[model samples]
Target: MCYYLKLKYFTLHGPLPGMPPQFLLGNLAQSGLLFDKASLPEAHIAFKQRYGDIYQFWISSTRLIVVNNLNDIQHIFTHRNIYDQGDIYVQKFSIVIPHGLISSKGAKYKRHAGLTLPLFRRGKIVSNFDLIVDCVDKLLIRWRTKSPQHVHLDIVQQSQNLLLAIFGLIGFDYDMETLDNDNDTNKNELTKALQYFLSNFNIMLFSPKILSTIYFKLSSQYRQSQKTIEQYFDRMIKQELDNGKELIAQRKRTSLIASLVGSLQQDEEMETNKSEEDRKGLSRNELLDEMRLFLLAGFETTSTALAWFIHLMSKHPQVQQNIKTELSNNNSQGLLSLDRLDSLVYLDCVIKEVFRFCPPINGTVRTLTVDDRLPETGAQLFRGDQILIPFHSLARDTRYWSIDPELFYPERFLGADKDHHPYALIPFGGGHRQCIGQDLARFELKVIAARLMQYVTFGDGGNQVNSGGHLSKLTIIPKHVGVTIDFDK
Candidate 1:
């Protein structure tokens, strides 16, 4: 026998004790189907009934071990060394976009995350509430004009514009005001790039490697769109570098890019006193990478979450009414401020519940770094083995959440229930590798949701809202949604 045969004999000696494979597509046919129409709750229900809490599934040729039990999730997240960040999908993304925090793994991830973390410190986020409120006010102004008309608003577009405005203000100190203009090129290109990235999710279901390669090569439009995105940032970064001194002198600025560039420059100056060997600062490309990630990951994920929140609110009118009443009773003027947003318990519950109902990233894959057996299942997994955790399925598992897993109930997230198992609700993920932008994203959602509720009354736009056939490259997003926005005016 060849060396390959010897390795197979050593590694794949016996059948794993879990759900039997489904010939070709494996459990993916039942679980990994298109997101837009896929009933994640139903899929989890079926899996729980058939294969128990822990089961084995396959997507393409890759084997996935799904875990619904909270203990399993805690074990997986806490043991970061054993479960290193998965590189299969990140490697594919690096081909099309520059690798940054989201794609970088291991020590590189650690270093970049450290550098980026200080920028999003709680104080900075609190200080920047006005910038967020400003963007929301612009959106509210636009909504007021369309109110009472029962406009069939492309909510996805609206949310994208609102997020882009926030990104522009913070990322580059460029006030996009995209909501004012419907045909802005920069806004359009950003939206298109996000859509392309979203499409990559399902494209992975078919043949990720081949499709990704083809997408980078044959799709000239996508390539150009990406280039446009890069160029836009490049110009903004260049402008900042050119005017850095003046901006720095202007004190008390809230822009994220301003803070980053200032921090880098300060680090560079401080490095001058140290030995050349010890001096380390971000290069031009590194700065761009950080900015790109902030714009792309920051805006895209927040926009998608906000869109889903609105859609869910529309479907559940009572929840919307409760939210409205809560806001009405409270002073709407100061509610958008960070202090007030932090105090809004019900608002926080609603946002958390939205995440439970529809997590932006359905699942994350991690490759095993050491040969080990799953604690609960006792199944042997070798180094280089890939494990998939489907958050979409886990969040709605009836075993963990008893209150009609599919329903949108914010109360389930409040009070004592808030202290439920860590893994039970992982919208922002768990452990050290959790999303870096969680706090910022949550703040953005609360500020936006609170402000919008103050001015507009969301209603079912006479169209069924479903997260079917949803695609995800980096984050999960609704495909195409049309909702009616009725203004409170």
Candidate 2:
């Protein structure tokens, strides 16, 4: 029956323009095999060779159109109404993240985005700069202790800790200080939850929710850990509410949640002048869900990006040294102030290059709300078509980037020539729905990378980090990224 269904689906679509579709399973098996172990860039290049620039593939009954060109990405993102985040992965993300920006869509997403945008404004991000620097300082101190030895540092753990500290300051006004105090329960629990989420990516993909529920019931530790995260947030929210009146009166610290609660309180006060429906604010459950989304979204992507940056730097010694030299000239004290870090041009290039090289979110899946045709290829796509824009592939495409696309060249982003195709390097994405925390992420990466370079020199640890393969998860991550950090001076 399954075989017959596969044949029927492929037979209906006779190679819709760019490339021919396979008789059975379409190009799904081939695409899956390429992505199974190779990096996103390699997979994209391989597919482009076999199935033109844009190709269609089917995984069982689901059909996907992979787009590797900048023009195509612009078309999809700009025509926001036409393309929405529609994928099985997004559905799964909703299960864990609830109604956060990453999972939410349409008017609901827009409204929430409106309410939350102010919290991540430049002024607000600048206010949180000190907290970011403090986190980086703590990380450097740890690296200093392991001086002169090849420290088998888990880049992933370090990145997670850094982001946790940043998010704690911004979200709950809590200083995690996980880097300094390894035994912090709040830090440990959050870390465990994230790690567990990543580790069980495949299970979440294949296992049905009912089966997952049964498995969670059987696994006492998973149940306990999940409960810990829920209880922690619940207590934190309650405590904030309890202190809400006093907090508003004093206006001591500025947190995203505080900003939100403050805004809602003001709306309530002005309720008499507004319509009944307009006066309604986010419910307690809604607030908690939003908080969960902010925490996970803010931390995971930034941490993952940093891990890749460190791994890449270790591979390219010349680029690492250039960053080190640039840092020395700017901040001789090795203290990374946000202002000083911003002045390091070479360091900024390195971060941008790393992002371009290995985008944390490799590709985003969008579904066409209405029928549309590509301007360049004139390929017609119907409503409900799933489009995969491989950001990793576009960044490295030889057609776009004239240099050896595979090589890690920070100079590609340096002065004068900084204006490459805008859509070409879309690590944070493009259009209205670009990453809200991009500036914050950039700040965190700059400070962390600069401070680390100041204190240590990362050397190749015999084996290359396996930063590829098919992880049944939201983000593309390194399978087992091992690095050796050597302390300097």
Candidate 3:
């Protein structure tokens, strides 16, 4: 038909080159994304080599232009209105969390962000230092009981629990107590619901929207999990609303739910004190969606990062020693204060290198609002076209780094690559729409990493198990992270 010919020829025009997409599969068959030969990050690098920085690729019926060049990436990220959150990202997240900040845009996004953003400000998150350290201590205690010969074959699971516990306590003042659970078998209803959401989110993401909707409708297990999550969050929100005003007046430490509750209280008071239209804040449903978004984003990305950090430290013993050396030099013993944690400059580099070497999320997507041209590559873009800004490609691109980009050297942050390009190593991404909880994530990683260094050392459990590679999930996690946890004298 004429439509097929138009899609084949017209879609590939405008100086952009791409592998010819097969009838329905598009480039999915050729891109190695379907098969497990290479992870998405590796495939991104490979595709860049073949098609240059700006190349069109098809994921089934949808068209995506992979922009590997930093100049173009910077432009896209900086101009927020022109390059909004991608349709794919929005469509996928909106299925479950339409009112949540992640799936919203324009005025709705701004309204939600205005109230919630302050809760995650550096000052507020830093004050939760004690709670974060307490969670880390619980993990340290659990790890101390393990025999020296017992290879810590579950770093991923341990990290997930630690983060989930921390997020629960900090965000909602509700203790997940995941650290206390022996295994996932003992997880509570809320925990099970959360697990169900995370475990099956990728499935929904990859499926066609209509098909995913059908699946959601038909699956009793899915409906039950959603209902459980909604009830639990609703209960918590109500509890906070009932008791939160006094806490707000007392000027207590801010938990996310508490802050939202306080904001909602003010909105209620405004309705009474002023005209109906003068009141502002998120509705109950909006608050629930936000909480769900917080839970998913808070634990998922950071937990994967922690797992990768442990895997890397296990392989590089010298790097572990260097961290300990940094801690010792600063006299960072016992429970560390924010000031003491801040003084570990080398530890900062190691975290940066881990993120650069293997970012948790492979890439972020943005969609064009209007037709535009790339500043560096001169590639033409059309309205509604989606562009993939790969974090892995940008970090590993040789053009941006003074030293070899391939090496997993943490020292790169201190030496030749100290002044690397701004967009070259965006683990949390860049610009206005970047990960809002970045500061919280960084703080959690630093506190946990510093405490682990102070108490224990991770040793390589041999190549058979600890061989480095990644498993692409909501976040790209280490597929094989077997490390031996040794208690310090």
Candidate lDDT values, in order: 0.67, 0.69, 0.82
Q: TM-score, each model?
A: 0.83, 0.84, 0.92
What is the per-residue lDDT of model 1 for residues 1-489, given as tens digits with 9 covering 90 to 100?
645633432222245535544434445565655443444434555676677766665554445666666776677888888888766556555655444666677655665565567656566676667888888888776666664645445776678778988878766777655776653334565567656655554554434456557766787876776687677777776767777567744532455565556546445456557653454555455566677678877787899899888878777888888877777666755344555667677888899898887788767767778987777766677787766677887777777775777777899877546676668888877766677788888888888888887777767665554433354545666655656777775
- Model 3 TM-score is 0.92
Which has the better lDDT: candidate 1, or candidate 3?
Answer: 3
User: Which stretch of 10 consecutive residues in model 2 shows the poorest summed lDDT?
Assistant: 465-474
Model 3, position 40, has a per-residue lDDT of 75
Candidate 1 backbone overlaps, count: 7
Ranking by TM-score: 3, 2, 1
- Tens digit of lDDT per residue, candidate 3, span 1-489? 858754863356456888876655556567766665567787778888998988887665667899988889999999887899888877877788877888887776777787778777798888888888899989888877889878878788789889999998888887787888675357677767877777676566555567677888888998999899888787777767677578754533456787666655344445457543444676666777888899989998999999999999998899999999888884744547788888999999999998999899988888899999889998888898899899999988999998898887999888889999899999988878889999899889998999889889899998988997977678888888889989986
Model 2: colliding residue pairs:
none
Tell me the lDDT of model 1 at 411: 90
Span of 10 residues, lowest total lDDT, candidate 1: 5-14
Clashing pairs in 1: 36-467, 36-468, 36-469, 36-470, 37-468, 37-469, 201-472
Q: Candidate 2: misplaced stretches above 4 Å?
A: 1-14, 17-42, 58-61, 87-90, 182-187, 205-223, 246-254, 260-279, 330-335, 415-417, 464-473
Which lDDT value does model 2 have at 64? Answer: 71
- In the range 239-279, model 2's lDDT, one tens digit per residue, is 66777677753552346766555545344356546653454
Q: Please tell me which model should have the higher lDDT, number 2 or number 3.
A: 3
Best by TM-score: 3
